[model samples]
Target chain A: MSVTVPSGFRASGVVANLKSTGKPDLALVQNLGPRHSAAAVFTGNRAKANPIIWSERVIADGVVSAIILNSGGANCFTGSFGFQTTHQTAEAVADALGVSAGDVLVCSTGLIGVGDQEFRDKIINNVPAAVEALSEDDDSAQLAILTTDSVAKTATYAGDGWSIGAMAKGAGMLAPGLATMLVVITTDADLSSVELNHALREATRLSFDRLDSDGCMSTNDQVTLMASGASEVIPVLADFIEALKSVCSDLARQLQGDAEGSSHDIDIEVIHAKDEHDAEVVGRSVARNNLFKAAIYGNDPNWGRVLAAIGTTDATFDPYAVDVSMNGVRVCHAGEPDQPREMVDLTPRHVSVLIDLKSGDATATIRTNDLTKEYVHENSAYSS
Target chain B: MSVTVPSGFRASGVVANLKSTGKPDLALVQNLGPRHSAAAVFTGNRAKANPIIWSERVIADGVVSAIILNSGGANCFTGSFGFQTTHQTAEAVADALGVSAGDVLVCSTGLIGVGDQEFRDKIINNVPAAVEALSEDDDSAQLAILTTDSVAKTATYAGDGWSIGAMAKGAGMLAPGLATMLVVITTDADLSSVELNHALREATRLSFDRLDSDGCMSTNDQVTLMASGASEVIPVLADFIEALKSVCSDLARQLQGDAEGSSHDIDIEVIHAKDEHDAEVVGRSVARNNLFKAAIYGNDPNWGRVLAAIGTTDATFDPYAVDVSMNGVRVCHAGEPDQPREMVDLTPRHVSVLIDLKSGDATATIRTNDLTKEYVHENSAYSS
Candidate 1:
């Protein structure tokens, strides 16, 4: 029970034959609510997919009755015909659920530029079947949205008489401002759309926004939150925000653990910076450095590469006054070798790199994965 | 006859036992000139090598009498002792050539943090042998300054009455603002240091500055030009600049061809941008995109990745109006799939990606290579 874990929500997953493997490839989630409040965030990439464009319009009015998502084709760079297909899918969902078409959202993921007439017909024909299969405690919706992911990611937060349930799917192309993930969250809290939007932005900024795996932004990424007044619990705004942040961060770590062909989950933390932005900039610079990532894959504590990477950023810091530590061992002190690199064990799957700028009091962390031969192989053979 | 192809230059390569392979690892070049005028550039990375820090002071007076370069150990992050080692090496060269230590520039390349007492002793002990072996026509200096490179890189430009000769060594870490390369250029033309500086800056800006094989910048990168005025004939400044540009561009291509663990040399050209900077920003974004690079490695014309890459930049362009062509096939036209991707051929060692930003009339090109599994292997096994 992922999206349907919350009360007043029904979800179903069905096989639409969008994938050649005959796996479940379509999902539908409906809100049987006294209040139809919703908020969403799309990919920051300018070249958005057709479904993303349609969903942005549906979410503008802060009311969503249902959402229909598909796997197999991203429906991006497919021109006006693809946009028509997304619109038709939403209209089908509205007709089946007896809701306004303007209040239905659409999402798609997989290969780009693959939307055709057959793709449109398969989704439109399955709407009725998906609506009939909806249940109050179904976990199939979590399985229908994965493309390259090895597992389903779901997180739940039980508050005071209120709960939030979320499911996310992504395996690669994870970077800042969100990855190639499609997420849907449902809550039984008595909250308005405006309040939900405020909480979601702050939550995602500290969670998904710090994950820079591979540093590749996607063209089709969406995270949505829907609220139903079933619980009638008017919780404190601060408490709600903290709960939401916890769920998002949990899902983000799950995504990192399942990233495509990755061997190590590395956390690059920057401390003693001029500000939060400076610390983030410094951490992101190291996170995106391919040479440094490859070194981590080889289990080499190459602190010099870290220095070289951070040197490229405009963040305020003295290159010679910085310190670097791996795990719990300080490898570099004041930009010189301290502990022997052999003392730092990197055989574990989790690696932590600590960088002290020795400037101020701000700090941040960026999560990334190592570069490996398997990573090159997976991406090289992805389309072929 | 690389750097010695021009007049008034004597160079030699000697064994210093710095490398485990028992190969020549030290090189010395002297400007036995009537007039010594030099111009040089170092890496823009803030975490510079100790040699770079010392050489910067030597080139400040626009006069350089000699330059010594070594391979097998980059004198970086070795503490103040590393700076002392660099200074001692320059002093050794100055004493041998009967010049001021301030007139000698030094360069080193290899694994960072490897300069120990033994490393310094080996270099200092071999200075006398290197000086005694110097000759005007020897090419040993070209062979000595190589780490992971498979071939010696040399380029020559013969003007009406004067000529320019240059040699460079770098196989990885090639990026904008120069790579991990150490270059030495010699000319017999009659020119002042001010004139040489102007021409060298312009030449490098259009040549090596556009070669971004990987997005990694190095802490030890330098390019130096020394004019001897041996020909005693002054040429037009514009003609000299054009000749230098040609030589630098030729050498840059050679570096791209020999880039470590690369199979295909890719050239991403952005056309009709708002300005040159925008064109460069757009081209470099695609050049550094690992997804696009891996797609090219698989010989797949995935144009959607190209659109997604350029969309990440702040360049002036409408994503919907862009066109992407691989080789001669326009795979994506006006943001929609036009020609099929199967029509494009990528079997050759060279691949071209053309992006038409239909926003203005400016254009730029960036050179890069495909991301391969061998790259991971080479870098992982390095510094071991």
Candidate 2:
């Protein structure tokens, strides 16, 4: 497995012993290139992790040499000690790569505020060995950044003369308006940080931010894109933007597929809303509805929950003006239930809800998954 | 099973056949002469049930003589037909009691958009028999308006000069900003419509609106308070306000206890917020958190989910200024983990979350329940 082989970068994953499960828990990625431009998106959660704070400051410079990521400890709500640990981890990575500490971004996920001095020491001591093992063909870096994920997620897309490859890790702690997914993208395109940052933000807004599985956001959610300018032929900016969105959308779908305790992936599409904001508001409300998700999990195409959720939004549309279609069957029309719920079979792994507001032409789409007993079991049983 | 034995009201429950289960599905209550002053609260959900629309308009006069309620099928999203059912139900109840139809209010709850011609016919035919059976000892009225509830919910508080008794039915479709708990209170006190309405609004804002179990607000939610004036001794408005709040609080607690698929009752208390709105915003955010609910269900004291939920709120406060206590154990403080996860035990059936915002004197409390597999099972298995 290789994480950076498709781009102008080197990466490595190491065992840091931060996790009691003894899995690969540390990863380092370095942009070994002449043009080092970067962009990032952080969690909107106010209680951010220490690594997010550190990485946000570092990524503000529009260039980064390396990113040090670790699993098992979120380093959030840890007071000054957690902040120090994030700083120390970044400094260690910077020292090994001979780059300024400010140029080294950091990210951590797992148990919040649990790492102690011993854990910090182990991470710092392993930095030299981790850096020495760095290679362009190492994909363990992506694997190391996983916490409750059952499998590693990776997506690669090739454009005219540029390439975009990305990886993410998250199983639970998912919701709308951004979830707990951590994404890292490497690209060999000649784009400025301003352009890359704008594109990444817009893409994420339409993709990852639309996912609402359990309506839980983690403190350490981060997405970073690095441009190494290795491609000689420049691709059109529009094509690059489309490719980026495609990659993010693919990763978002993969995350939904691997959602913890999820038996089905549900896509909520709101069309003909009064405006884009209203569509998003309605879409998110439907995405976070536990009853709707459970209905899908039970293979019951109950669209009443959809109506109830839409009723909570500020969307400018009469509830009576709405139409709901589930799995190609119209379950509701003009606000009243019209079709037999039995006609819509929901046992499939994927379900779609198309809500026509009968208002304006704005639309928004949200990706989510059904809630299952296994999700409750896994989340409740986990100590963190 | 007595619905109005504590006060000066006549009540009855009848089989309207709105449900396929053939259970007693309609309830009627008359003030039985004296002060007909009334106050009511409807669901905040923008997409309201048709009965809510009818009741909201009729109650504006604050001179209601009767309230007609039906369960098993919520007359929501039925468009004009739904509105007509509510109107016809009110008319039937009024004619049976030999009163004006405009003086009677209506409420309905259950599956949405399923109440059709058959339901309307059932109400029209059975209401006369129900009115003849009206008695203070009729407990069946309380039992009639139930869907998935495990038990009937009723409460009574006797004052010096007057008595207040209330009944409610809700198990699932519960969330903050008002769950689907239908409540009706009767008191034999002489109070003006202005005073009664004010008291009812204040009581519900702090009580029913604060209970969020599954974060799914139902289309059919209502709380009505009727003053019969059987007790000639009129008390001060302040005393009546206190009594109303007490009844609401009691009903709210019962609703939480009866939450479907819930094994533990969780109370989230937000203190030292900028204002009541801010505190409630933070409290509801935590109450709707699936991760935190799952953690409580698993008996794992994962307070990180609490912090993450609070982070989603726009309340003015530094994340680092927060302190959280689970049950009696201090788990987090100053935005960092304060106690070992092992030290915090969640074995008790009741859990408490105390969050100190350190912002102001205002505080708010929300009642919720842990997410369980049974909740998912019940919701998913239930048909439209």
Candidate 3:
């Protein structure tokens, strides 16, 4: 059997027993590279996980060699002890890979504030084993980084001379401005961190930051892009940026597809806004609307819920100057119901809402999913 | 049956067929005056409803003789047609009650942007009939203002020499800064509009604004306070304010309890915040969290969801310095898990969460409810 691989990246997955279930819960991905320029984004959440704090500092140097991620426990709110656990995990990975400890990034997602010494010890002892197990054909590493996700998500785009490959994991605690999503992208493009960082931020603003399935921001959300510079063909940076965005957007859509208890994926497009910022504000406001999400779940195209959501934002616009279209059918015009309610079709697996602000040319697109009973059942039944 | 009548007020409910369902859906309340001072609060939503726009302007004089409320059609976003409908409704009510048109306030809720000339004609033609049915003993008036509510909500409180009575109707489109809630309060205490307005704003800031069951603000939300001064008891203005707050709080709780499709009512209490504003911000963020609401639905005492919700707010404090308690059991303290997960009891009709900000002596309380399948079904299936 052939093992799947990402460009310029080597990966490994192992059972570190961090999870009592003894499931595969630990992963390691190394940028085996000539140039190690890197760009990363962390959760905007104020109550950030310990590993997020560690990785944020590590990526400041514009380079990283490896990332160690665990799925069983998010080392968050564990105080000083939790920070030590993150440090020890990174140190272990750094030592095993013969790299600087400061160059190794760490991420954890699962239960918060449960980082005991025993968990740290098991992680430390397993690092060498994980390093030894590293191979070019280890797709299982991507699978290991999932907590409640039903499946692993990976996207790869091959360009003329360079390739971008990425994997993401998240099922809930998903919202705009960065969800609980974790993504690692590896590419062989010869790009500097300055350009990489700028491109990554722009890509994220339209991709991960636009997905607001559950309207919750996780404490351990992180996205890192590593350039291995392994490819000799130097593609145009503009093309590379587009490729990066494609991967992130694909992963973000996958995250929404796997949203806990979700019945349908909904896309909200805010067009003719004052600017991108206003479009985002309006898009996010609609994406986080519970009534709107629920209406989609029931396959009901309730545009009134859409108007109510938009009314809450500070985005400058006359409510009466807007038009709402669902699934290509204009249901509302100038803030009033313009079409027969029965004309809208919302029972499909996917739904789209287009809100024409009629004030400017700016637009934004947000993706989310409907809330369902299964989401409640899964989160409530899970002890963590 | 004898209605739960509030002192110093007359009420009536009529069937005007504003809703396509042909249900009884218009209500009128008059402060049969010994004094006519009044105060009102409208939705903060920039896209104000037509009736809200009318009432906000009419009540500026601090004197109101009557209030006419209609359900089944929110005269919002109907453009100039909506403005005409609202105007005609107030005029008809004023004519029927023999009061100045400027002194009669109007409120409409339910479907938005569907009120046409025909609907206005039906309402205008029925005003005299509704007036003839007016009675202090009719509780059906409260029922008539409902759109999707499963039960009518009304509250009354008696002071030493004065009394306060209130009614509210809403189901979905509920969120912070005010939901779709429409509240009407009648008081027999003598007070100025200046004093009443100040008290109404302060009371609502802590009451209706704190309830965020669905996180969608309605265009038609309005809270009106009318004083009849029937008791001729002019207590200290501060006492009157306190009594009003008590009434608003009670009505807010009732609204949460009857939140559409809700199975559990959650009260999140934030303590030791930098001030009441910060506490309210923190509390409202949690109340608006879909994941947290789902966890409560599944009966899972997941505090991580709570932490994630609070992290999104700009409220001042260290996430690590926060403590969370669910139903009297400290589930998390100082940013770490403090007790066994099993120790918390979340399977109650009412759930309480106490968050200690540890920043100041200020505190605030927010009321909300768990998201359930029925809520989704109701909102989604209603139109279709």
Model 2: per-residue Cα lDDT over B252-349, one tens digit each: 88888888879999999999999999998999899888888888998888888888889988997899989999987888889877877788778878
Preferred candidate (lDDT higher): 1 or 2? 1
Candidate number achieving the greatest lDDT relative to the actual structure: 1
Cα deviation at A333, candidate 1, in Å, is 0.9
- Clashing pairs for predicted structure model 1, backbone only: none
Candidate 2, after superposition: displacement of residue A163 in Å? 1.5
TM-score: model 2, chain A:
0.96
Residue-level lDDT of model 1, residues B1-384, one tens digit each, is 988888989999999988888888899889888879999988888889899999999999999999999999988888899999999999999998899999999999987778889999999999999999999997889888888888999999899999999999985433442236888999989999999999999988888888888788888989899999998978899999999999989988998899878999999999999999999999998988888888888888989889988988889998888999999899998888989889999989999999999999999999989988988787777862
lDDT of each: 0.88, 0.83, 0.81
Candidate 2 displacement at residue B209 in angstroms:
1.4
Candidate number with the higher TM-score (1 or 2):
1
lDDT of 2: 0.83
Q: Judged by DockQ cut-offs, is candidate 1 incorrect, acceptable, medium or high?
A: medium
TM-score of chain A of each: 0.98, 0.96, 0.95
* Candidate 3 C-alpha error for residue A233, in Å: 3.6
lDDT, residue B118, model 2:
83
Query: Number of clashes in model 3?
Result: 1
lDDT by residue for model 1 (A86-201), tens? 99999999998999999999999988888999999999999998999999998888999988888999999999999999999995423343236898999999999999999989
